[model samples]
Target: MTTAVITFSPQGLKVMQRIASHMAVDQYLHQAIAAPPGVTPFERVVALTGEIFSRYEGLVYVAPCGVVVRAIAPLVDSKLRDPAVVCLDVGARHAMSVLSGHEGGANDLAIAVANITGAEPVISTTTEAVKDLIVGIGCRKGKSAADIVTAVTTALAGLELPLERVRLLATADVKAQEAGLLEAAAQLNIPLRVIDSDLIRHSTRPFGHSEFVASHVQLPAVSEPAALLAGRRTSLLLQKTAFNGITVAIARENCPSLA
Candidate 1:
């Protein structure tokens, strides 16, 4: 899903630059401040937000939370239809999920941005205690978003687990910009993480091998290794499995039982 990052100050611009390096977002700055290359200037955030509110899937504010709230208050609609909104302070210490925390994916979007900015992610939407499940996926190029959703849902269903326990979706870096993967993550309201191909290729973690992948993509495997590599002290919960043209695997961070 497409996103826009907007800021009100020079300090915020610096934070925006850091975010741009890692995520794909259209950049915007206040009209009074001179914008760096590729960043657009807006006279008023409220007006601009109103105009583009429906165009983007997410809006990240590198400004005060109050200002962000005021600017978006008028455009605020339903959680299911509203764009994901996240706020980061100029110092970049916190990434807050301001709107659409569930249906529209602000919770996961904030986490993804926080991961990039090295900020703490703030999500208030209550669920069962967080679980560290990572779902790894691989798909044929140009697959539709449904293809990805099906693969992930099917994998999770086998365990009778809900989406809340899942932390993120992991895939090889080559699939970072895959349209299907991106939209599927947005649709599922789960963060999508891209593991570097070099890391996946060099990983010693024992997962099933795919001759088709070795011959075609030149990697030992994609799904299982991606899940294994995405979390800390992770162990495989599910091995690689094929769903039509997509492949899926599941991994969880190894923590002692609370029970």
Candidate 2:
């Protein structure tokens, strides 16, 4: 579905034109309608434009005035798929992403448009820290939940490790409680450990309980050990070239409580 940009003034048209020039022509559906001053509230213009594209999926509305902003308020709450609503002043001084940013890719798109139009991009969320390959592993609402579960299960098994041993499952904590890792875990009879930033920092092993603590826990070095255990369920075997008789094994164990 093409992203929709609705505007009322010639100045707004210029802003949309600049945005379109930078992006694919088919990506945007630009509607330049003339609204006379004091004839209709800005809100009514947004509502009317929204109603025209109500049946289409992935429609993003951008308006340039406060009155039009107020008019678009109701449409903001409507049950539409992939709706990205943004507003900018007629002068193209600032652009605000008011709704459906992260999942809808609005923030990124807004920044792109802002750069082209010389408007400020208002992004609030901080970027994800400790970069790793992020796999989207959950089912979205209004879709087949089982299909998602099956796909995740297949990916997990293909990794060649006991499913229970895979730690650091990333997802919304609350969503994890409902429709996240539980189904995949049950299907494979493996425990799925949910993790966030705090856990990722302290925990050495990404899988089941581990007792073996590395003498030093540092990056680049720690990544090697993690790579070794990526697909294996057992402890890693390390050999010392100097001492032929001595060998080192790293494994996860239960942590002892101070109490």
Candidate 3:
């Protein structure tokens, strides 16, 4: 596994260096004093830092406050492909697991580093790590929106749920209009329903039901709306409309009551 340490302050850089040296893993360690152009310092760090460890399988890191850590948060959330993210205070007195700690060996690394540096390791991804159901899907690079829809459709079908009983769909609105999604819905005899953002906002039923399945499709930045909808029984379909990504949640209706 390769690790990239991004920091702006000299003191923070030194702390990262010590951790890297102590770990003694065959990892790439790179330091940047300044953020790149046209990007926030955080985004720059994530982009540059990501490149350094691209050749390796895993990533470990000590991100200090400032642009570097903030910008990388979303990218790490969306991309990074299961990379381990750990944050360190300026003096290396405390370490926190902010991302990918459980599955990516970040917890073990935190313990090791804490023992050596005498820093307290704070882990936050405990629930996700234990349950491990938050799966990420990546569309093939440079693939067309149509292709992405096909892939997602095929993947959803493999889950093997009855197409008619599904309801409660969620996704970016733009994906609701994609040719691939429409086609898949027609072929599968499902409804590609649109979700209103406000519903997902003020509702306690985020997960809807165990029978409910969610799909996220990428979309173009300007043409998407974050939306969610619930119904008693309706099949749901998701297709990627653009590059920004969308999430669809499908639920099965309860049996009709005859009073």
- Point to the candidate with the largest lDDT: 1
- Name the regions of candidate 3 deviating beyond 4 angstroms: 25-43, 56-60, 65-69, 77-80, 127-259
Candidate 3, residues 1-259, lDDT tens digits: the string is: 5655555565665675676566554322233454333212443555665554444434444555454466455555433365666667768766666556656666545545654455655654534222111111222224354554454454446566433333212233434455554454445433333443344334454332211122323222211122222233222233223333323333333324411
lDDT of 1 by residue, 91-193 (tens): 9878999999888888878878876775757777765125668999988888889988988998899988877788878888777788999999989977787
Worst 10 residues of 1 by lDDT: 123-132
Cα shift from native, residue 162, model 1 (Å)? 3.4
TM-score of each: 0.59, 0.38, 0.38
Candidate closer to the true structure by TM-score (higher is better), 1 or 2? 1
TM-score, structure 1 vs. true:
0.59
Model 1 whole-model lDDT (C-alpha atoms):
0.86
Better of 1 and 3 by TM-score: 1
Q: Over the stretch 1-259, how does candidate 2's per-residue lDDT look in tens digits?
A: 3455556666666666666666542222233455433222244464565664455333334454465457556666543343655666657766676556656555545554554565655644333111122222322333333554555445544444343443323232222454434554454433222222233345465332222222222121222233233222323322111112111122222213211
Q: 150 in model 2: Cα distance from truth in Å?
A: 32
